[model samples]
Target: MTELKQERAIRTRTRIIRAAAEEFDAHGFAGANVASIVERAGMTLGAMYFHFKSKEALAREVMNSQTEVIEPLLHSEGLQRLVDITLVWSYALRDDPLLRAGVRLAVEQGSFGLKDDSSFRRWERAMTECLEAAKKRGELLDEVEPALVAQFLVGACTGTQLDSQLSSGRSDLTERVVRMWRYLLPGIARRGAIAAIDLDPGRGRGA
Candidate 1:
């Protein structure tokens, strides 16, 4: 009986989170309505409050859920791995409501008085690790700094994705990300490495 209760509880929480993501994605944090979220989840207000105490808590969970969409990129390393991450994220942003909500909330976090920047920092750390590996493998230019480039890459991706979102609802995000990499690689990659790196937006689909 206890096990069954726990499973049902988990399911209820998951449903509420999914519904919250949908609402938050469609409406910014300030605009999202808890009543509507409960309606979308097919749950009562008391049921949702049992899992998340407040709207801010729900928003934080939605933001954190963005990491759930990323699969482990075990087959590649260095520069290729870095590119794969961005391309995969572009596709994820288009397909996953949770990720889209998280990203939107992240950009508008300031409006809600949320100070968390962990998501952006996490991306920077991942990119920095990949760039460091690339530098060790002689794939990067001598002057390229892994940490600095990682920060720049994250900013570039943020801008490109926002532009894509506003222009076409991210229908062309992958192509835009490819263009972003094309513009960035020449400045950071080694002379011989630029031609060797695959810039195909579809490359991440298999990764």
Candidate 2:
């Protein structure tokens, strides 16, 4: 009975989070309504409150849930892996409401008095790890710094996606990300490794 109850609770929480994500995606943090979220989830207020205490808590949860959709890529490594990660994320931004909501919330969090850069830091760390691997494999330029390149890549991606979102509602995000890599690779990747790196945005779809 306890196990069944726990499972039910998990499902309820997931439903609420999804609904909250949808609402926040459409309405931003200040505009989202808890009543509407409950209605969208088809759950009672008590059920939602049982999982998340307030709208702030729900927003934070939604922001943190962005990474839940990224699955590990198989047989990928080094510079190509980092490129694939960005491409995969670009695709995910178009398909996943949770990620979209999280991204919007992350950008707008400061307006709501929520100061958190953990998401950006997390992406920088992931990119840095891949860059470090690339460095070991001689794929990186001799003068390139993994941490600095990673930070710059994260900022570049963030700005690229935001522009794509503003112009085409992210319809052009993947293409923009491809363009971003095309411009970035020559600066950070070794001359010999440049041709070997795949810039196909679709390369990560199957990965």
Candidate 3:
């Protein structure tokens, strides 16, 4: 395809994805309708079909794109960076329809017969990388295992956000995440390092 046509196709695909995210987030997989997504995207059925063959394909794309909102933290290292990333993610969970939809879809995918663990594995890998850096820097306890800690962090954040969403539509997720780190750090960090790490829940966003 020519440059112009390729750009247009990309734009149309993005529009369909965003519209599908909105529909999925609001109504979930079973309730979401392709016609509504096409209408919301202001695109014809052919355009959506050209990019995504089915709703399951669109959902897979959404799940695979779950890391987009946390793109800002992809290169960050250390325990502090981990806290910052989770806080940023909690905020993104509240403010980004695409992320919220992706997470919700991932959690509910079993019901839809669309199983994919790549997103969850990615989260674990990212956390493990950060924890490894923190361990190398002497920020964590000598006995702390990066892989275990990474798993714990992912599970904690997932459950915390799920509860926050259920209770307050995620309005207070940042605070909840802050509490999570506050509760978790004492057990994982070195005595001197515990007090130094920033768990502000507002670090990455300039708050």
Candidate 4:
């Protein structure tokens, strides 16, 4: 396609994804209607299908887009990044239904795919790489298994989102999320019941 055509296609695709996000966020994945999504996008059902094969595809698009929001928190921000990430996540759970929906979809992703896509795979790699970097920087225990720790961290975030949903009306939930981090993150990261880490990394994005 020509550059202009590619740009138009990209714009159309974004509109459809946005519409799908709103529908799915307001209504759970099972409840989201493709017709409604297309209408909201001001595109025909044909146009929607031309962009996305199914509602699941649209949800996947939203999930993929979320990496832009999360990758920074998961990588490169160091220990200080998680605090800000958690604070923002809690606020998102309270205010942005779309983010909560995205979280829900991510939690459910393992059950849906026959094979995890490259994007899904990257989440683990990103976490592993970051933890390895922290270890090299003397911020984490050298003995800690980076991959295991990464998955555990992801599970912790998922649990926090669940807490946010269960408490639906609470505002101070952010603090609770922060406190829960200690349990999952452990101020002293250890490896194989030995080599406990020291020092507070001063939580910011990644705990």
Candidate 5:
């Protein structure tokens, strides 16, 4: 494709994804309508199909794109860095439609004929790496296993945000994640390291 055509195609695909994200966020994958997504994009069914083969494909795209919202914030490391990732991701879950829709679809996709776990695994791996770094730096307790801690942190963060979404539309998600870190820190980090860690809910935003 020529440059102009490629650019147009990119724009069209982005439009479709944004529209589909809105529909999925509101109705979830099982209830979302492909026609409604096309209409919301202000494009014809053919145009939507030209970009995405089906609703499943569109949903998968949204799920994959959720990481885009956090890839930039993942630049840091260590235990505190993991906290930053969770808090920033919580902020995205609250504010970014694409991410919120992607996470919802990722959780609900098994019913929609796609049972992908790549999104969750990516998050787990990132957390694991961060914890491993903290362990090497002597920041964690001697008995702490970085891998187990990573899984626990990922599960805790995911569960907290998911509950927050269902409870109050995620308005209190930051506080919940902060509380989670506070509750978890004593077991994972060395007593001396605890004093240096920042658990502020707004820490992610400042980064």
Candidate 6:
């Protein structure tokens, strides 16, 4: 394929994945039917497999892609970026089906235990870099371990999500999660880092 053709191919693949994401969200990973996903994408089973080998594989790719988008946004401009990351994640956790599905799938799988996923190594690396930058800048406690901090943050966020999924959204998981994180991270974050979280987008930091 030419460059233009290849780009189009990539876009088409993205569309298929996005469509599959909704299906996965509605049905969970194992329950989501491939033909339904292909049909929703207006593509054939062969075409679906052309981009992803199987539903399990596609779900993994979906989580992996979310990590890519979220990782950069997490490490932008020091503490401000961490706040931005949390805020972005809060809204996304509530509103974005792909993110919700990944959380749900991870929970429903039920065999991973409480240990951090070494399988999500790329995600761990990204968090390590961000946390190390904060530590170097004195935005985090001096003795803090970045890997442990990363795993703690992940658990706090994903655990909330898994709990929410089991009973629907009746318990206000998002609010409770943000509150818990505020307490957990501030203990380790600089004073400035704690205050850096008020980025309200167009309304200024706290207007």
Candidate 1 lDDT score relative to the true structure: 0.87
Candidate 6's residue-wise lDDT over 75-132, tens digit each? 3655555545555665566657766666666656554333324335655566666777
lDDT of 2: 0.87
Evaluated at residue 12, the lDDT of candidate 2 is 88
Residue pairs that clash (backbone atoms under 3 angstroms), model 2: none
- Measured by lDDT, the strongest candidate is 1
User: Highest TM-score among the candidates is held by which one?
Assistant: 3
By TM-score: ranked, best first? 3, 2, 5, 1, 6, 4
lDDT of all predictions:
0.87, 0.87, 0.84, 0.63, 0.83, 0.66
Candidate 1 lDDT, tens digit per residue, 37-126? 999999899999999999999998888777556646335789988888888889888767888998999888999899997777777888
Question: Pairs clashing in candidate 6?
Answer: none
Off by over 4 Å in 6: 69-76, 111-122, 167-171, 199-207
Name the 10 consecutive residues with the lowest summed lDDT in model 4: 192-201
Candidate 2, superposed: residue stretches over 4 Å from native: 1-9, 73-75
In the order shown, the candidates' Cα RMSDs to the true structure are 2.8, 2.3, 2.2, 5.1, 2.5, 4.0
Better of 1 and 4 by lDDT: 1
Measured against the true structure, the TM-scores of the candidates, in listed sequence, are 0.83, 0.87, 0.88, 0.74, 0.84, 0.80
Of candidates 5 and 1, the better by lDDT: 1
| lDDT winner, 2 or 6 | 2
- Worst lDDT run of 10 residues, candidate 3, spans 198-207
- The full ranking of all candidates by lDDT, starting with the best, is 1, 2, 3, 5, 6, 4
Which residue pairs in candidate 1 collide? none
Point out the higher-scoring one by TM-score: 3 or 6: 3
lDDT of 1 at 133: 98
Supply candidate 3's per-residue lDDT for 89.
87
User: How many clashes show up in model 2?
Assistant: 0
Q: Stretches of candidate 5 above 4 Å error?
A: 1-11, 42-44
